[model samples]
Target: MSPLISSFRIAIAAGVLSLFALPAGAAELSKELSTAVTHAGLAAGSPDLKMVQTHLHHVVNCLVGPAGAGFDSGQANPCKDQGTGAIPDAPADKQKLLLTAAALAQGGLAETDLAKAQAAATATQAAIKGAE
Candidate 1:
């Protein structure tokens, strides 16, 4: 290849890679956190156990984003386009809260009982409320 063409190709490749490497910005992370809290609240207030689980799944989806583990395509992504994943995008100081919230949301997913799931949802909300 000509030197100029090789250099152009390298620049294109670097630009593509940079897009994936950059972390979510503050505005995107904030939107994700707020959406997660809303999903948790919805789970807690759901009338049926199935709906509770569904909403809890939404919370998990929001926290983890499409690329993170525990993301469920079956559940709607409330935080889509907000960030890569709330936990992954979170600042170092705020990661703990997002992780706690994610754990609570996972627990809610595992719960068979309505009350237990609701409790988990409430706990999930509390854990992330401060970060939002």
Candidate 2:
């Protein structure tokens, strides 16, 4: 397979695995984050909206399945599991900052929202500078 196709297959597999592994409540949070990012990108008129939407769709699909059914309210409540736990309540501020960066990247707002985008990007970049 082509490198691009291979990469896509790998991503799809990972997303499926992640969804199956997440606790019901944590899965909802993940879906919410994906939705927020998509909406923010749309609001920003992101040039890469299609790519962002694809990624978000993959995420939601992986977490919620093909049916697109979101977690029920009770199942969506906050609760963190140990080790492989889901962050039931995702940190709102951090998610906002990350979503801002995603919007800037997708919207190509780097040129238009230069200062704001840069600042947000810098902060988001710092937050994930190192990872395992």
Candidates' C-alpha lDDT: 0.89, 0.38
Segments of candidate 1 deviating more than 4 angstroms: 1-24
Task: Please report, as a residue range, the 10-residue window in candidate 2 with the lowest summed lDDT.
Answer: 77-86
Give the root-mean-square deviation of each candidate in angstroms: 8.0, 14.8
What would the per-residue lDDT of candidate 2 be over residues 67-107, giving only the tens digit for each residue? 32442223222222211211224444444444433333333
* Top-scoring candidate (lDDT): 1
Per-residue lDDT of 43-128 in model 1, one digit per residue for the tens? 99998899999988888888888988899998899888788988888889998888889999899889999999999999999998
**Best candidate, TM-score:** 1
Q: Which parts of model 2 are misplaced by more than 4 Å?
A: 1-20, 46-88, 91-132
Instruction: Give the TM-scores of the predictions, in the order they appear.
Output: 0.79, 0.27
- Count of clashes, each model: 0, 1
